[model samples]
Target: MEILNSKEMIYSPTENREEKLSITGRVTFLSMVAGSVLALTNFISNSALAEDVIKIGTPLALTGGLADEGKKQQIAYDMWLRRVNAAGGINVGGKKMKVKLVAYDYQTDGKRAGQLTEKLITSDKVHFLAAPFGSGHTKITAGVAERHGVPIVASTASSLSVYNQGFKNIFGTLAPNTGMTEAMMKFFKKKLPGTQKVAVLGRDDVFPRAMAKSLSKGARNRGFDVVYDELYAVGTLDHASSLSKIKSEKPDWIYLTGYTQDLILLRKQMSDLGVTAPIVTMVTGPAYKEFVDGLGKLADGVTSSSWWHHATDYKSDDVFGSTKAFYTQFVKEQGHDPDYVHASAAAALIVLQKGIEKAGTLNRAKVRDAIASLDIVTFFGPIKFSPNGMNQVRDLPIIQVQKGKVSVLHPADIKNAEMQKM
Candidate 1:
């Protein structure tokens, strides 16, 4: 997918003596200052005039393991930008200003993400910032934004540990990692009464490890015995040894958490080792279409959890009117159904815009306060940020792949299907 460059450059009046400005641009600039000379001077000196445009800096992973996720996030950002621009931009302090994004491809490196975040804040001079793809990358980049006192909205970082750091400027869209297993455990206890043994496995990373720990606690709290729990090092692709050990315990439920590629490889190895569990739950991968495309029938009955889905009856005043509307437009544009990742990415930008509008000024502190106090419902879900800057309004939805289609299985209000045995 081609990334759209949403940044618009404003040229000085001295550059073109006879050129005419667009009606929208001229009107937007005139509303900023009283006289033409002062407007021209402000335009020449500060390219990102507060009256003209709201610039958001974003660092994306355009290469390496997270490249696919980065592309989907970029697409969501672009979609929001186009919709805001089409509506004559965001309304701020009684003036309309266009939105622009200053984005860079970080190549999926944490060090590069830190460097680019500094450059985006100090050199590019963006008003707000968007976090990188994953939890580890977001933690590194968010530190830079916090030090600079720039507000950053995180799209995908869901680990509780990420927000536990003392940073007032960072905010997240998704719920905490514990929500993933909390919902599944409640559903499993009711649906499958005899399921008591569970084996938990995860990658030795910030997000995956945190999720595994939460799952273990939630399982044990609900009277399920944890037969085996272990964490493998990152980049340890061969999981035959772990599968062999897990097979010996004969666990009724097997839960795995990791990145998309890691989960894909683990599922394949489980089949190769002839290790079968009545219930298998994987974090994040089964919610994405690529998981089904890669595993075919193997993805069937494999359950997962998500922060948002199109089956909800939620509505928003943003570009996408409702959950159904957003899903329709995303599928129309991308040629596939969007997962929670895409919805969360768009919701992050929407929350930022709402904060700026509520504050009615570009001041960082006021905007940050507005975000901290936000209590609005969005197409993605109800997005109310806790005092810790993590979303606490939405609950994770339990989903399973039935007949090669993603089916919502829990939360009786929006569930489209029931839990099925693997």
Candidate 2:
């Protein structure tokens, strides 16, 4: 398998022996060059060997609509790789085994992603697997992993539907979609009790639509009038028609759910169409700094909720030790603030590492059991998998962008600022 993000730290094991040959062309060994040739040959031989290593295969959408999110995942994985190698790798049966990540670019095609996942298991013989970007592609990869009896972790998938399937080999780092949606509904209702009318908009995809349905349910439960609800087609460039309808409904709050790019365009459309709401909250857009920096003044007062934030204070027994430490190192290395996506992706890798270490072996079933029964906290937060392999942590951070600052507003303990009303 081709390694898309090796970066010198990660390992790439090849099936063909010919590919491992380092010395090319004609090489004549003289009396003086004998020692140098022997040293170079030994170095090449050691680097080519993949023994005593743990290989985890992942399919990434490196060149498509999901490329930005995919790059975040790669960075998180590489961070884990560097840290693990620095600590002499994971302890397995009293031996510290180095890690090798085998990543393949699926080009954002769901079918190709599934094929690559299966190839990783059968052909590449990867010990574990990390699913693709979001719920839609992850479900496909998870199914393939299940059929092959390989344990797989999903960092970005949160839709309850993906976890509802009776799969024995799938686990996710993020909690169910209901977790974020429920947290947001309670926060909004408590902060602005007079917000009776709510409007919901989302992408017509697996995760966004599922999150919208969960948000709609939570909104109604909080005694709010669901004035308007709609799902736009994927890759929709013009949201003027949908914004006009929501504006006519005169809702007090607008809840939107979609990817980073999709929400960026949708927010610009809302501004162009004069759609105003007292509390305009988006599920995941504001989690990244690009959202605020992209729209200087328009992103003000736009609130969002995420599974984990760098501002969270938590201690972990993992490599990073604490949330603050991870954030510090991530910013130092990446030269920018990491978002919820980066946190979740790193958490997924942490889960696998803990499982392999706890089980004391590389057996798939044993590691899977260790992962499912884990009840520990990490830099990301408490991660305990339910029977269906979905994270049970519900300590979501309610956030808002006020004057270009992403601030936490709710869950009083971590609130750095109050929610700014428009």
Candidate 3:
């Protein structure tokens, strides 16, 4: 027989006057009980540890066509995670639960994006999910998250089509392209007088297609002769044909709506073809240093409309401090300024953190309700979700690049510089 240790023995209650239980027998009994108790305690400890980890998954195109935008979002998200971690994680129901961010690169492929999202939700079991670059990528996760009952916030989906889907689990950070069109036209009317014969070129994707439609409608409505409008593929390399067509139309202004590569190539083609019309403007996402560097002097004087401008110094602006802080940290870490996509993603996290803090619980349903009903002010402005979960402040900033630097030129309250024609 094996000898047992002291902890293995225990005395039993007895009314027998003669004797007590045997030590060996007691030892065996105590050993079983101690083993059972240890097992139970370990199980409980593991359960607590699991509860402490809140998994957040993101599928971004870190490489490939949408690489530029995807990289920006990842940078912003890193800053967000760092800031939240630095502040001692999220306070959930009076207890601090550390955030765990799980990111995957979809390589700018739509199918791969969906595959990654499904794996994150089913295999990795992330608690929350973030939106990636394009509308198609966001739509894939929308269906997956809805089926799994996980709420998602789309960090870069700017298409109005996202809201039209009526998926309760998905919400986007950017305003609809329709709103941007109206705002852009209004700004042009105010800033540039006698701007007629407008030519618009857009990528044949959800965002640029919708934006181009709205821009064309607004231009025609405002009596600004819609001279030539064309839609090219998202990743189209040659803009020579489009430029030739627009040149033949003899438009006074050229309006472009597309992502980085298309914009950079088109600008170079425009300069190469000497298609200088004195009224060229693009709708956002290309006013960054990356775009300037990609196109060199070809990027000079190009005006673009954006949602955030770091130069604006508004005392009441909610995002000023946070934006500045993010830019400082981003430059230090990534050696560059956070672009619109990055800034938008950071702002999304800020709003989400506020909602989580207000709800005071880690319950998914409760957090979703809190986010839906949240009306808090954030770094951008007063952040109140509409019935469809869009931010109420849909105003965009019109920025002009002067001497390789971006400056806000519209919305008098936030305008820090005068407009310069490109």
User: Which should have the higher TM-score, number 2 or number 3?
Assistant: 2
lDDT of 3 by residue, 1-422 (tens): 11111122111212121133235777657655665565556556646766886677788777887787887777777777776787678887788777777777788788877777888788656778888876778888777787787778877777767767777767667766676778777887777787888999988988778778788888999899998888988568798988998998888679988876678878888888878676788766455667888876677788878766665432322333554565667688887666667777877776666666778876667777888887755554456666676766567777877777777777787787887765
- Give the TM-score (vs. native) of candidate 2: 0.89
- Candidate 2: give the clashing pairs: none
RMSD of 3: 12.5
Q: Rate the local accuracy (lDDT) of all candidates.
A: 0.85, 0.85, 0.72
Of candidates 3 and 1, the better by TM-score: 1
The reply for model 1, stretches above 4 Å from the true place, is: 1-50
The residue-level lDDT of candidate 2 at 211 comes to: 85
TM-score, per-candidate, Cα-based: 0.89, 0.89, 0.83
- Across 1-422, the per-residue lDDT of candidate 1 in tens digits comes to 12222232233332233233334667546533333565467566665465588889888998877899898899999988988899998889888889988787888888988988888788667899999888899999999999999999999999877898989999999888787788788888889889999999989999889888999988888889999999999989699999999999999999998887888899999999998899999987787888878888888989998887778878778788899888998989989888888999999999999999999988899999999999988899888898889999456789999989999987889999989999
Count backbone overlaps in model 2: 0
For model 2, how does the per-residue alpha-carbon lDDT over 26-90 read when each residue is reduced to its tens digit?
Answer: 32223225444554564577556556778999999888888888889989999988899899989
